[model samples]
Target chain A: MSGIVATIIAKYNYWIYICLMMIGLYAMITKRNLIKKIVGMNIFQTAIILFYVSIGAKRGGTIPIIEHAHGGQSHAVEAVHYINPLPHVLMLTAIVVAVATLGVALALAIRIYNRYRTLEEDEILSRIRGS
Target chain B: MKKLGLLLVILSGALLLYATVDFPLWGDPSSPASLHVSPRYIEKTMEETSVPNIVTAVLADYRGFDTMFETTVIFGAGVVCFLLLRVLGGEEGDHYYRHLPTGVTIHVKGAKGKSLSGEFERIDMLWTPYDLVIKTACRIMIPFIQIYALYVIAHGHHSPGGGFQGGVILGASVILLAISQNLRTALRRIGEKTVGILCAIGVFIYAGTGALCLALGRNFLDYAALASVLGTDPVTARSHGILIVETGVGIAVMATMIWIYNNVSSAGRYDEGL
Candidate 1:
């Protein structure tokens, strides 16, 4: 059982990330509060960040920095294993995208609140339909 | 309604699940994405561009056209907000205030509100000392924040940053100022007119730089042509060109974001003076 647990831990971070992503999506779809929907969106984006960061990770690898000034031009090197830098870079872009999206979404939410005088998703919907 | 919503959601989830079966596994070393341009980019970018950061090379040079469109997308959002929410000039003296029970007060103080003295005084107590403190802090920080933004823009080439990241930081600084101080004060510091002008100017700086390369007898964004001005090296010229354009993008993005936020938050009621 302990060995099985270790195997699962070693291999299943992706599954956990996927689960969180789905849960967030489910909340966004089913929750009747606008703020909850925003929270769900945050969770979904965070899950994507986790997935990207995980991809960049290499087991027992060091940070992706060349040590000396003379670390010459060779893809093959010794005693300097490093994690992939590409996913980390991609994750940085993703973070900026998420923040921008959040800003726009929140601004819309504020506008909706002003127009309908409520943040409950159902209330806003009914008010719109009534209008 | 709940049942239908749940059922539709479940069906969508099922469809998403089906789609995922064909998707590449997370972090697969053999994935097509890893095999393609990315690996080549990683390997050759430093030698080709003489910039240590591969992401910066990809963003500023290799895929610069995409970055241009990304800025345009932001500009479009700003224009849409402005068109949808702008109150025409000369009717600025028609304003009203409402003090909701939730403690969120709306104060419309301007030429429009000159006739509504009674209503204005009624909500005067709501604009307390705390509001003044927050406003003062925003005033003091705006310049420093903008300078820091410029630093981020300039230093992006050397570090884990770039045009988009620096642009967003600058945008957030302006947004913070707008939120803490009143929108009018923030606008006076960087007005809609200036923002609109700067937004165009920013895009022009980016596109114009690329166009300059074309006129100088090279491909679009071949910064090598600017070698005479920037120094006698293609690397230095490219570095100089990228920094300049990134500053342009940062300015445009920051202004547009603040403009959009102001318009959307005001919800077409600019007479309120935010």
Candidate 2:
């Protein structure tokens, strides 16, 4: 049991991401307000980004920017000395796409609000049924 | 229904947590992700591209196609939002204007007398008194913020920023202006047509760079082909190409962000909104 606890503690980043993902999922699933759902979606994206970035982290490693790189460095750059750049690069695109998604979602919400005059899913549904 | 959702969330959470047992521990250098193509990128980045920042080199050089499409995605989102929300033509609601000298507001019903002469400024229906402190503070800060944004884009090769981050900062500065003043004030500085055109232009710049490489009889986005045009060696040309692409990205991203904000804040009316 102690060994299992230690193992879980060592991989706590993944656990935290899982918790965050669950929270986002709960909000997305249960929230009636459209804006809340969008918030939940954002949280979900954040959790995924955090997960990828955490995977890229290396113990005692520096950022991927090479120091003294411009002045013709003498020493060779070791891969282990730097954190993973691929995930960061991928996540940069993900972050931009996430913002674009958020914008589109909000624009959609605005359109829905313009038409329905309310943002609640249930209210909109009932109104649709009544109409 | 809520209980069902809670149950589903708990089940998924447990499943994900159990799956985490197989994942490498946090910050493990030997993790699978670190062991893959990332190491080669980190080691060879400076040599191949002459860029100090591995992230920028990898993003703009190795994965240039992806970034181009990413810019396209941003542009598409902006276009979609514009289509969904933009309401062109005259606004039908009551128009509000403030007399500058007397500090008194005049409400004009209908679209008959829309234009206002000097000393009478148009305002939003939901307009509160414009805060002098906020306006003055942002006015002082806007120029500096814009300059910093330019720095972020230009210095991306050696630092933690690139076009996307810089572009967003530039867009945010404009957003700051809008929030500080009214939408129309911000719109006057950057008209709607200009923002839309800029959005397309940014993407065009990115795609155009790639096409330029292709025109030089090289593979798409192969910055090595740009050596002749830039009058630099192949390696340095790659670096310069990345900068060009980054600039394109910055412009597109900056314009898209502003475009989205303009449409969303005004709900396509281009008038009074927060």
Q: For every candidate, what share of the true interface contacts is present?
A: 0.10, 0.93
How would you encode candidate 1's per-residue C-alpha lDDT over B1-274 as one tens digit per residue? 5576567656765675565656455445555555554566555655566555656666777777766666666776677667656665655542434444444455565645254433332223223423787778877887788777778788777666667667777877877876785555567777778888887888778889889899989898888888866666887677677787787788778777777777765564442234
Candidate 2 lDDT over residue span B107-173, tens digit each:
8888554678899988876889779999999999999999999999999999999898899999999
A14-67 per-residue lDDT for model 1 (tens digits): 666777787777778788888788889989899889877876655554544423
The alpha-carbon lDDT assigned to residue B187 of candidate 1 equals 72
TM-score of the second chain of model 2 compared to its true counterpart: 0.95
Docking tier of model 1: it is acceptable
Give the lDDT of residue B212 in candidate 2.
95
Per-candidate DockQ vs. reference = 0.24, 0.87
For candidate 1, give fnat to 2 decimals: 0.10
Error of 2 at A47 (Å): 0.6
TM-score of 1: 0.75
lDDT at residue B172 of model 2 (Cα atoms): 92
